[model samples]
Structures are given as structure tokens and as C-alpha cells.
Target: MKKSLVAALAVFSLVNAEQISIGGTSFERVDALKAYEVGCASNDADACFEAGWIHYQRQNLNKAIELYTRACNANNYKACTNLGALYFSGEGVKVDIKKAKELFSKACELGDGDGCNNTAFLYEQKKDIKTALKLYKKACDLGHQIACGAYKELSK
Candidate 1:
């Protein structure tokens, strides 16, 4: 993680946005990204996720990674899964399967179906079919559509 991201998070942690608010704030649909950025700067995990997603759409992968790292550190499962996807696919950063597995495992621990499914895929790649099957079952139970199919295929 970059020092800048950590520094921003540390600073945000010291102050609450609402405590410093002077007047009413309106978050228009068109300005949603701006609102998310403000909220993220205030250390809101969901806002960090929204901001990261916006950055990702804009092809600002470094910014997205920083914000996603913040959100993931805050125990936001979606952010963990997305961060793992980035590492797994080598989109903006170098491919690191171990890091991706670790992040996906964290997301799975937080009850994300996508995370469970992804973890299972990695396990399958390593030829650990039993573990993969178990993870696939868990993911399937959690409503990961692809995991359901994978589980059935592996069961045969």
C-alpha cells in the first residue's frame, strides 16, 4: 500500500465529516462521484468502494487500488473481492496469485459469494479438487451462479 493512501486514511480517521458540517448537503445523482470522494475522504468504507468503482470506470487503476485498499482494510467484503480481482487479472498491477487468494479468502470470511467462488477457482487451478469442491459448495449456497455449475461439474 502506498504511503499517500495510508496517510489519507489516517487523516480521515481523525475527523468526522458530520461533526464539521455547517449546512445542508445535497448529493445529486450527477454528482454522486464527488459525494463519494468526499465521503471516502471522511473514512466511510462504502463511499470508498463507490469512489474506487468510479475510478476503475475512468481507467484510473492506481486510484482505484488505493481506495479499494482503504475499503478492504475497513472490512468491506466487496472491496476485498474487487481488489483480489485486480491482482488476479493483472489489470493495473502485476499478477500475484497468492495475494489474490489471500484477499479472496478475506472476502470469503466476510461472507461474499464471489470471493468463495474465486477462491475455489484458485484451488482448482492448483489441483486441490476437494478443497475447491468444498469452497464451490459454499459459494453455491451463497448464491454464486457459476459456483453452482462448477460444483455440479466437479461432482460428476
Candidate 2:
């Protein structure tokens, strides 16, 4: 029993070691940010996207936009979708529906389900029911749960 307790404690410590404590605040796997930063510095688009996601979660919208833009420029579809959302909602930049639409279209072309759904939403707002239904169907087929619900409602 003592041996089992010691082994369990060791495993717990190993797992917890990956987390970071800053000024009495503990954060989950903060070291992942460093790894992402290094990968982004090396021009890895996925890493840039991940770093942007972390900044977004922390409510650092400016930094998130910056990193997401970098990843989007590298043709990261998910990054483009996220950046487009920020622009669409005027989170860190001016609201530019045209730019957001363009980015959403690009991401949809790259097979991103959220992009398809967002593009459908824009079309729905524009009263283009046909295009909205088509895009929503596409998103639904790509396994977007929200899109599936929207598609069902719109189809009905």
C-alpha cells in the first residue's frame, strides 16, 4: 500500500509539473505557450494559430489578432476563420463585413465547418436564403452540430 501511494504521488507530480504557477496563480500547461511561440517563430502556421488561441482565451485580443493574421497568411484555414470572427464582431479591429466574408469563404473552401456556418450566417443576414441553406448544409455535412440544427430549421 505504501509503495502504491508513493507511485501515485510521483505520477501526480509528473503530471502537475507541466503546469505553471505565476504570482500565486496556477495555469494549465503554460509551457505549451512557449513551445507554440518557438514553433511560430519558425514559421509554423499551426503553432501560430494555437498561440493566437491562447491569447484569445486570455482576452488579449490584439495579440490574438496579430498571431491569427500570421497563421492566416500562411493559409491556415482555422486561423482565417478565427481572425474573420474577430473582424466580424469588431473585437480587436474595425468591423469589416466584406473582409470577414472573404476570409470565411477562403476557410470554407479549405473545408472548415465553422467557416461554412459563418458564411451561411452572413448570407442569411443578407436575406440570401438559397446560399445560406446551401452553406449550412455543407457545414452540417462536415459535422458542425450548430450548423446541423440551423440546416434543419432552415430546411423546414
**lDDT at 147 for candidate 1?**
99
What tens-digit string does per-residue lDDT give for candidate 1 at 50-115? 779878977999999999999999999999999999999999999999999999999998999999
lDDT of model 1 at position 105: 94
- lDDT (0-100) at residue 130 of candidate 1? 99
Error of 2 at 84 (Å): 1.1
The runs of at least 3 residues in candidate 1 whose Cα sits more than 4 Å from the true structure, single-residue gaps closed, are 1-30
Q: For all the candidates, what are their Cα RMSDs to the real structure?
A: 8.2, 8.5
C-alpha TM-score for every candidate: 0.80, 0.79
Q: Tell me the number of clashing residue pairs for each predicted model.
A: 0, 0
Alpha carbon deviation, residue 141, candidate 2 (Å): 1.0
Candidate 1 achieves a global lDDT of 0.83
